[model samples]
Target: MAVLTYREALNDALREEMERDDSIFIIGEEVGEYDGAYKVTKGLLDQFGEWRVRDAPIAELGFAGLGVGAAMAGLRPIVEFMTWNFALLAIDEVVNAAAKMFQMSGGQYNVPIVFRGPGGAALQLAAQHSQSPEPWYSYVPGLKVIAPATAKDAKGLLKSAVRDNDPVVFIESEIMYNLVRDEVPEEEYLTPIGKAEVKREGSDVTVVCHSKMVHQALAAARVLEKEDIDVEVLDLRTVRPLDVGAIVASVKKTNRAVVAEEGWPMCNVGAQVVDDIQREAFDSLDAPVARVNGLDVPMPYAKNLEKLATPNADHVAAAVRHVCYAD
Candidate 1:
């Protein structure tokens, strides 16, 4: 087993997939010559040549539309937006064209495309670049949305997304790209889509989270262990087609749950989880479900304010304690 940074894991997935299939190509701003805004695609251009690994102008909408057209024309394209914030410019391509292609054509055409890049708040990046759009993309019916939290998941999920026949939104958090390291399999592997992985097992409380918040939940679980409060952490690898069974079973065992998310509190991913739990696992719960979410405000430019706005270990721990000991 070799340890890899989140960025390297993603790059490895892209490189391996491209080598295995000639139809797959990567196109985005600075993805080739610049090696990506975060260097996730470094050295790819040289190995694959310009035809396969391309650099596009700073036009997300233009390149994204081109990628969609290419996918419909029998090529698999991995389009990278520098950050998800820039993806707003290409919303029509993603929400309408890519997501609706199969149904719109009555199954005559399939868009095997992957639109990915850093998502969520990056410190000091300010409001323009700091929002999390996973919830927005998950709302669309035909798209597969994946937000991987660990190095292993990053590689495995990206590989699966590339091979699928439908368009996928692969989200990676900028904060986790270089900070987290984990053991990744030497041989390539693809984690199944629509599955959840339980990072830690507990019998008292279930903590459902994804992406960077998964780490926060795990950290909080570690601290709660010292107080004899066991917390089960469920990493919902794919937000859409969420693994509701895994979450329900965990809640059944614990009889309590605290959903954690990095986005705003209103109408967020966490809200959806709580809704599903109440609908499917109502009798199994012993207390009201609690949600730990980022403050409902634009991410601030100041480091301190930004830190305060995002959900962290302390907030997670507090929520877990509240739910576990609820009267």
Candidate 2:
């Protein structure tokens, strides 16, 4: 095992996948010459050359459509947006063209494309650039949404996303690029998509979260432990085909649940999770399923306000307390 930052792990994943498959290529703004906006593609251009690591203009829609076309032509393409906020410009290609091609053609075409980049709020990027769009893509049936909270999961899941025969929207946290690290395996391995893993085990309550929220949940679990509240942390690595079995099992064991997410509350991923729990594990729940989510309003631009608006360990711990009925 080798310790690697989230950014370096992603870089390794792309490098390894491209090395194994001749048809896989990467295309995005500044991906080649500038080495990507977040430097996740650093040194890839020199390794694969301009042909495979081609740079596109600052046009998300055009380049994204090109990727979809390339995928339909039997070449796998990794499309990176500087940030998901910028990907709003390319939703048409992502939702309509790439996602619908296979189903529309009755499985005649496979859109093996991965659209990835930093998502959700970071620092004080403000409302426009700080929005979380996971629910938007996950709402669509044809698209698979993946958000990995750890370096190891990011590397393995990305490799799986690239090889998937369907359109995938891979969201990364802007703040966690260099902030999070993990010991990644040296040998090749793939983290199965549509599975949830219990990061920490307990019996008092279950704290379910995904992406960056997983870290917050883990921290909250630590805080609760001091007060004699055993909190279990479950990370939903894949947001689309959610591991309902895992969720139900954890909720049954704990008899309580609190969902944490970086997105807004209205029709958010948490909302779906709550609904699923109520329907599938209604008898197991001891209290109402609670949610700790980003403020319903647009993300604030002020530093202090941003901190208050985003969900954190304090927020998650409070939600856990509410579900567990603890002070």
Candidate 3:
């Protein structure tokens, strides 16, 4: 096992996958010469050359469409958006073209593409750049949404996304690029998409979250431990085709659930999880499922206000307490 930061694990995965597959290529702004906006593609350009590590113009819609076309033409393309906020410009391609190609073609074409980059707020990036748009893509039927929290999941799930025959939206947290670390397997591996991980086990309550919120939930679990409240932390590594079985199982075991996210509450990923719990594990639930989500208003620019807008460990803990009736 080798300890690595979230960005390093992603770089390793990209490098290894490109080495294994001749058809795989990366295309995005600053991906080649600049080594990715967050340096996740650092060293890849030199290793694979300009032909594979193609640098693209700052046109998300155009480049994203090109990636979709490339996928239709039998090449696997990884498209980086710099930040997911920029990806809003390319949603038509991602949602209309890439996602619908296989079905539109009547199963004759498969868009083996991965659209990735940092998501959610970082420091004082404010409203324009700090949105968590996972649910936007996850709502689509043909797209697979993945938001990995740890370095290991980031590496494994990315490799899997690269190999998947469908469109994938892989979101990473900008704040966690250098902050999150984990010991990854030295051997090649793939963490299957559509899975949830029980990061911490407890019998009193379950805290369901994805991406960076997993760490927040873990921290909240620690806080609850002092109060004799056992809190289970379940990371929904894959947002689309969510691991409903695992979530239901966790809720059944804990008897209470609190879903958390760095996104808004209305029609968000956590809202879906709340619905799932009520339907699949309604009888098992001891109390109503509660949600801790980013403020409905646009993300604030001030550091203190931003901290308050984004869901954190304190917010998660409070939600857990509400559901567990421990407050």
lDDT of 1 at 198: 97
What ranges in model 3 sit over 4 Å off?
none
TM-score of each: 0.98, 0.99, 0.99
The list of candidate 1 runs beyond 4 A from truth reads none
Per residue, candidate 3 scores C-alpha lDDT tens digits across 165-229 of 99999999888999999999999999999999999989999999999999999999898899999
Candidate 2 lDDT tens digits, 1-327: 999999999999999999999899999999998998899999999999998998999899999999999999999999999999999999999999998999999999989999999999988899999988899998998999999999999999999999999999999988899999999999999999999999999999998899999999999989989999999999999999889899999999999999999999999988998988999999988999999999988988999999989999999999989987885
The TM-score, computed over Cα atoms with residue i paired to residue i, of candidate 2 is 0.99
Candidate 2 global CA lDDT score: 0.94
Cα lDDT listed for each candidate: 0.93, 0.94, 0.93
TM-score of 1: 0.98
Decide which is better by lDDT, 1 or 2: 2
Judge candidate 3 at residue 36 and give its lDDT.
85
Residue-level error in angstroms, candidate 2, position 217: 0.5
